[model samples]
Target: MANLRDPVIGPVIRAEGLTKVYRSGPVEVQALRGVDFTAAAGEFVVILGPSGSGKSTFLNILGGLDTASAGRVWFRGLDLTALDDRGLTRYRRDHVGFVFQFYNLVPSLTALENVALVTEIARNPMPPAEALALVGLSARRDHFPAQLSGGEQQRVAIARAIAKRPELLFCDEPTGALDSATGIKVLEALTEVNRATGATTLVITHNAAIREIADRSLRFADGRIAEEVVNPVRKAPTEVSW
Candidate 1:
């Protein structure tokens, strides 16, 4: 079994009985119902579930994009629910990095400029060129997003996310916009960052094949954890079953 302490040897993210509900015209929809989860620093975890299974909802709550109606979230002993809007924004800006399915690169900006935009706001960010090199896009730093391929653009997005050296990285449907081949490349880039920087990484995906790359895989169903699996030996992205 993979040791829970292996990731940074300490817990970085913790959720206890997390619950979120939405009200719609006299009906209550429970997106997440009492879900408990923990992600240690430097860990690579995958969250898998079908549509409307609460995977995205879970991620959003952890990332501070949404609030839970019940339960508590503790990030290294700081109760996230206790934080106000400004505090939440500071927490996300200083400690967390987010990657979504869409690249969201500015068409008018070059790859370097796109990354620099975030670095400018970061308290202590790495140079844009250095971040691009880490993602294997140094050669294309001067090129615009429109000039790059899908996989390359995604890599740029990854670089932009990591430029600030965030403590935690959240990826939601990162490969949804790409084909099988391109998606594999994107996954490889993500894993490479996790291994190199030891950043706590959480990926929400519907693709079962991607589980092979995770230290721990969590399966969700009906707003609850259906199963949790640990990979004694996680396969490389290229070697994973697609």
Candidate 2:
């Protein structure tokens, strides 16, 4: 593992010769095939791909939700592929935040308490109130999940994910469930959080409109990165449209 404190000397995330395979009964499926990837610190990256393009699988491997059958992943200097199950769990809990398509907020808890759930156990987390404020949800802190719109609920989820100030933020199909107008707000929240926290952020989405907000954009196909492009200018999320 590299010294994580070292400032952008190398890739914040690096993966080499990665592969993932799933086996069930007599069926075997490959999700990623010989893929290599690198992400710099504080970079906002977006992965664009169709269904079954392996984007989520790659994000999962990076975020410690799933293991790669082959290859190695380096987070700063830690070898994720080499970590045992317990190590991966600790790594995820300590250094990574994830937002999915669904809000997944505890329906019983108010937005504030939902975010507080993670901050309470995090090593050096900001106050739950602060996290909520970051996503422009300070006024909704006491609202239950059912009382909020899809966009608001998603922002709450983002607040929870980032409350710990993790080094990485992984979002899988983050806007898939929202309408166009609501989705824009979610993306704006994500972009704002990325800029404010300087966390290396990666979002997976099928929508091409979201690509404008990324510093780097990747197209995935058949379990591999088909094309990668760097943006000289990043468009604000507010400018993106369906």
Residue runs of model 1 more than 4 Å from their true location after superposition? 1-9
Query: Which pairs of residues collide in model 1?
Result: none
Query: Model 2, poorest ten-residue lDDT window?
Result: 1-10
Report model 2's TM-score to 2 decimal places: 0.97
Q: Against the true structure, what is each candidate's TM-score?
A: 0.95, 0.97
Estimate the overall C-alpha local distance difference test score of candidate 1.
0.90
Model 1 agreement with the true structure over 1-242: per-residue lDDT tens digits: 34322334458999999999999999999999999999877889999999999999999989999999999997776789888999889889988899999999999999999999999999889999988888889899999988999999999999999998888899999999898899998998899999887789999998998999999999999999999999999999889777
Number of the top TM-score candidate: 2
Model 1 TM-score is: 0.95
lDDT of 2 by residue, 2-39 (tens): 55555767888999999999999999889999999999
